[model samples]
Target: MKTIEKNVGKKNIVLLVLPQVQLLDIAGPCDVFTSATRFLANDQAGYNVFIVSGTSDKILYSSSGMSLPCSHTIYDIDFPIDTLLVGGTEPGVLHEINSDLYTYLRHIVKETRRIGSVCIGAFALAKAGLLKGKQVTTHWKYADLLQKSYPELEVNINPFFIKDQKIYTSGGVSSGIDLALALVEEDFGTFLASEIARHLVLHLKRPGLQSQYGNALPDYDMMSSFTKEIRDLLKDKLGQAISVEYMADSMHMSVRNFSRVFVRESGMTPGKFLEKMRLDQAKNLLEYTDMGIEMIAGKCGLGSVVSLRRLFLKHLSVSPAQYRKTFKRAD
Candidate 1:
């Protein structure tokens, strides 16, 4: 394994792009690094960024139907990579890495200073055997699949990014920018990274361990029809406090029996599941509306701003105002 200290002069940052690549995953991080060079002024400490593919001159279409230009192919590259990143593709798209590509990845990893994947790009890294015994993260939607398929790897769905020694992995979409900012902070300093983030108009530099927002509904296929009914009922009544007895009665079961079965099927106690659903709804309202904290809390059945604040702090390490400020999209 090569050390980043061995690299001098401008580091070469390369991104490997597969077909159906998520455009934002590549562009957002690339822009972060590129902007750092500008922010550095006369520092002369920056990355030389470029894109590579399995084959040259191939016009790869993004998942959103945009064409991306590739500068080089894996078969032709001869330079040392200071950092290597694999950008993500749409979920469930089959990635066929031939022996040649796999061989190249395995060989290059030995010489590269650092390597990482963005979102579902973890699949590629896991396939290349680069993520063995490493704690990693991906888009929450695919976290379960990644864990099921690669039992040897530790897949965490909460964090926006995870770094196990020199290997790094990031969660979905814009989280790639957070990973890039972290790399910039590592290579340069917080001053330059913060400058680049400000230039990009990012709200906050989210820590790697911040919990990811997930769907409110539980997986129906994994639960009984009665459990699904409870889940549905909870979804519609997120703003109201419903007791375990009420939930059990809705499913025609005793409270003790319902609690046991709920945990067995959903992997969470009923109380915990209800809390998660309420938090998700609160997050949605925070991002999409201009509701006041007290109103939003009442709407989510959190009862009061004080109660919501406690849950937000416990789960996200941020206050409701902070979460809203950081994640609210500009209209």
Candidate 2:
């Protein structure tokens, strides 16, 4: 083990891609680092990106159906590393964590500058003993399983990602992009990193812990059949006139009882839940489309641009126009 006191000049970075890696997980960081390189004065040769695997020639497939070519096997790379990114594969895709590979990772950890994982990649690091006794995070779906496997892991379930010293871990699919942007900010400064975020059309940043409480990925079956029915109706008629009384009648219950059951079951008032859902959709629309705010508001059940701006101010801390402008830049 040696101390990384000498700042290694823009050096080689090995990205270890795996079988059934999630598309966004690998693409997110690649976009960030590649974009960051172009903006740096160091001629963008700072990073030597290599797709490494256990068997060098194996076709690395992602869950999104993209097949990436492997340039070298783990055993083939002899050069020292600056960053070693361990990518995630589907849960059952690669059951065998090669002992030799594990040993190799442990050896390299001492020399590595920073280690990173997107989503479930934390699992590989944990298995390698690199994450033991360290604060880390993974996609919430696997948070319990990872903790149960290694109680020594101080798993933070609330953040989209967590970093303890040189090792960093990110939450599920989309959070990988956020994690990559943060990495860019660290390496090339916020100015260029924000530029990459703009080119990628990603929100400049999102508080890592914000999405955990939104209840988006929670099982919808947690709601009863009737409750689901009403919710589905709301999704369908987002622009339709909706009220507590109307919602109650739609579910064939009295307004008072419906409100009580909705709150009891979902942990939020029905109106609040619908508002969150609408705002979430509106946020996506604002980022991904060229539609006017008024149009997005109409589609998201918020009625008008005014209502959408008010929601953005309270929840996202930016106006709809501003978010779009900041994220849609070319440079």
Candidate 3:
């Protein structure tokens, strides 16, 4: 690795690229730094950005068919990389990364001040032995694959991003921008980061602790169609007083058989699944509406505000009011 001459106080931000990289994973963060150069006026842009291919300095096409011409290759760039960021490749293209690429990544890890990945790029980091036992995250869809592929790594698919020591891992595409903004906040200040976020039209500087679970019940797709129908019934008729026997009767199965099959297929008991659906609905209503807690509970089939409160406390460790305070968005 060659070290570039220091330019007073500028940070060298290098994005490691590969063929068929997720384009947003590269463009989003790079645009942030480029925009930051203008936002942080008077001072020369605090970062000098570079894109380098792990194999060769040539044109590389992204997953979305966008072509980027790269002038620097890992083997050619001896510059000091203040921060090294790797963009993700589609799963189909993931096999293109060879042993030489991992070796280069390990070498760069030794030279760069901080090294991180965007989305499934964490897979490469894990391959390079950089994420052993470290808490990280990636796209929710790929989280299980990453975990199974690297049993030594701790892959949580919840948070928008995670920072464990010098390695930062972000969720899917847009969150890469959030991760970059967070880095800007750390290096510059909250005001600058917030301003950049505002410039990007983002609502707020979302913290890493925030979950990526969208406002919907996680469907148990592996379950039988009959079981899924029962689950759908529970969601649709949340306000009604329904029993396990009723559910089993609807599915034309005995209560004992229904319970066993439901649990085996869905990985959760029927009762627990119903409760989860109701609770997830209640949470969505609270975040997006001004409905009172009692009304929300009634609507979601939690029966009453007291029942909803107890469930929230038991499962989420927060009361309804506190949850609303933290998550609700103002119109």
Candidate 4:
């Protein structure tokens, strides 16, 4: 693990933005770096963060229709860049970008210490052939398209962010903040990163392995009528101790037949679906209320705090308390 101690002075963080880029992808990481400077001692070095436009335009319009003024183009930067991040744009606009931007990216890779993308900016990096055979991620909705377009890359949509050697890619818009905080933690230490997160009023500094979707339910439209009925029943009685036999009886079928039909319709056994439903309920309670762990556990039919912790750890890689801290609504 290398640190900013290797660098002699302030590290230069250059974010590249194009027309119709997502604003948060540019603003989030920049704010993280700028905020870090406020906590640094006068003698200590910090980050010099700036934006460079990929196009020749002096001003770029974001996807949200906000205008962003840029003083430098990619060609204008001659100094070494410690980190270079690409902000995301719509998929349609990605196709419209000029080839010169890809050439510039290929050329700039030689001068940068590290490079990364926020959201669908992975497409730009992929277009430049910078991510061949790399395990990466983008927004979950576009994960399949990214993989289909670039067969050589492994696209995993689970995590909020991921780092593969010197290259990084984040899940969606706000995950840029998570990625930037990670970079800060890497350059300095956890103490500085924690301080920055607190100042930003961030509830949780999520790990890279944490799933982007949490325990959210899959699309109901994709489920069969039988599966939907079962889901409805489970939702109403999530706090009760439900057995496979009870489910079978409610559906008016033999236990064996119920198991086979449920698997056929839901793609999972009744027990597995029940557990997933319980986990979803538990997550909802954790995020929306101030209930204690034991009460939440009982209400979700998870039995005890130990069982609840185990369920969260197995599925989410985070403890119940940690998940609550990260996602709980503000009072």
Candidate 5:
């Protein structure tokens, strides 16, 4: 492998984009690096971002029907990449993994400081054998497929972004911005990153562990009739003190059988599903209503503020107050 010499002053951040790319996956991160330059003392301490086409073409069409002009092809990149991020394409493009692209990625991995993927871009990295045995994530919709495709990799769908060693993978579209902000924080400091985030009009520079607010509901069509019935019952009586035994009796089954069937149908234990429901309700109330923590807790059937805070901390790594402050919708 031929080594590319690192740039002396500004770190060169390269984004590798393929055809039918998601525009935000490229634009969001590029904006973060570009915006960071404004706050820096000089150009020497900033980032220089470049867009490289994964294919031979210099022009790539985005998933949104926007045409993107690439400055360089993958073969044209001879300079050292401080960070290399792969932007995702539409699902149809993901099926055809380019062998040449994979080879280029493998070669470049030796010269890059850190590598990352935005959304389904993890598929590219995985195809190149870059994510072997690494804990990573992608857009929630494709997390299951990615897991099945690469059994060696730990595909966690919950986090907005995750960094394992030098590789970073982010969830859906806007999560690329979060990943870039974190990268900026790592390269410079929290103060600079926070300033950039503020300039971007971001309410909060959410941590990597923060959950992605994707589709939270289980697949109703796939659930058994009994499971669907229990789901509806739980939804209607979320604020009531409902027990597993009660649910079991209502369904005319023993607790053990009910638990087993629920797990098989819902893909989570009955207790876990109930907790998730309560948490989802609590989150909605926190985001949309001007309610007190205790009131919100009671409304969500969490019973007390302590339980609510504990649940938030355990799942979101943020307190109820903090979550409210960050996500509260403008009235």
Candidate 6:
């Protein structure tokens, strides 16, 4: 692998394309990286990006109709590279990467300054022995498979991203932005990162180590129809005071029995669930809307800014004002 370095612009960024690459996984980060470099370049738009794949260096069409032209083939490029980024799929396009792809990966891992993968791309890196004994992450859907296939690699899907020595890996699709932001922050500073995020309209620069389970709740599909009804009712009545007993009556059950079953299915008591819902809403409002803290409190069912603050601080570990100040989308 050969690398190219300019005086101040982005070093070479190589994205390996494979069959069945998820459109968003590849495109989303490409957008962010290009956006970040443009902002950093100010007037130059300095990144020299290339999309390469296992096959010919033609237009690598994604699962979606969008096609990104490959600047060159992996075999042809032998420049000093800053980074090699791989995109992932639900199940990757290749069952096993050809010896050529694997060899190219090994060559770069030994030569490149930093190596990383997005989503199931981590699967390929592990397959090529690029992530051996490295702390890594991938989309949650593939966590089980990754662990089973590459026990030598330390896999952590909970984080937005993970870095082990020279190898970096991130969770599902959009998370690549988070990892890229972290990289920009490392290479430049908080100001550059914040500006890039502003142009990209990313609200928060959530740490790569931040738990993906920060507020994980059961999926809508996991809920029974009755639970869905209850969940819907809660959302609708979020601005009002609601009680478990009231919910029980509406659902045609005794309060004690209803509470018992709700907790069992939701993994949280009624009060806790309600609090989470309100706080989640409050968080969104704080991040994206200009509603006053007091107004947001009322709209999200916390009733008062004081209660909202307490809950946000308790669970999210940030004050509403501080959170808004930091995470408010810029552009």
The local distance difference test score of each candidate is 0.80, 0.73, 0.78, 0.84, 0.83, 0.74
Error of 6 at 66 (Å): 3.0
* lDDT of each residue in 1-331, candidate 2, tens digit only: 3221222466676778877888777777777777666655464344666678744455777778889887788878877788878778765554665677677778888999888788888888888899989998887666645776778998776677777999988887677778877876676566666777888787768743534334332346545565577678787777766899989887789999999988665656888877877876776676677878888999987888899899877665668787677554343
Q: In candidate 3, where is summed lDDT lowest over 10 consecutive residues?
A: 208-217
lDDT (tens digit, per residue) of candidate 3 on 33-77: 877677766354468889888676478888888888876988788
| TM-score attained by model 1 | 0.72
Given candidate 6, what's the lDDT at residue 106? 84
TM-score of every model versus the real structure: 0.72, 0.61, 0.67, 0.66, 0.69, 0.60
Which segments of model 6 are wrong by more than 4 Å? 1-9, 42-46, 207-331
User: Candidate 1 on 38-142: residue-level lDDT in tens?
Assistant: 665544567789888844445678899999888888887878899999888754554554556667778888999899988888888888798889999998767
lDDT of 4 by residue, 203-272 (tens): 4476545352644344466467998999988887888899999999999999999999987776668988
After superposition, the stretches of candidate 1 with alpha carbons farther than 4 Å from their true spots are: 1-7, 35-45, 54-57, 95-104, 144-159, 191-195, 198-230, 237-271, 285-306, 321-331
- lDDT by residue (tens digit), candidate 5, 186-223: 88777778888889888445554536264244346645
Candidate 2 has an lDDT of: 0.73
- 203: Cα error in model 6, Å: 3.1
Clashing residue pairs for model 2: none
Report the number of the highest-TM-score candidate: 1
Off by over 4 Å in 5: 1-12, 34-48, 73-82, 90-93, 96-107, 137-161, 181-209, 212-233, 241-267, 289-299, 319-322
Compute the lDDT of residue 318 as modeled in candidate 2.
Answer: 67
The candidate 1 region of ten consecutive residues with least summed lDDT is 1-10
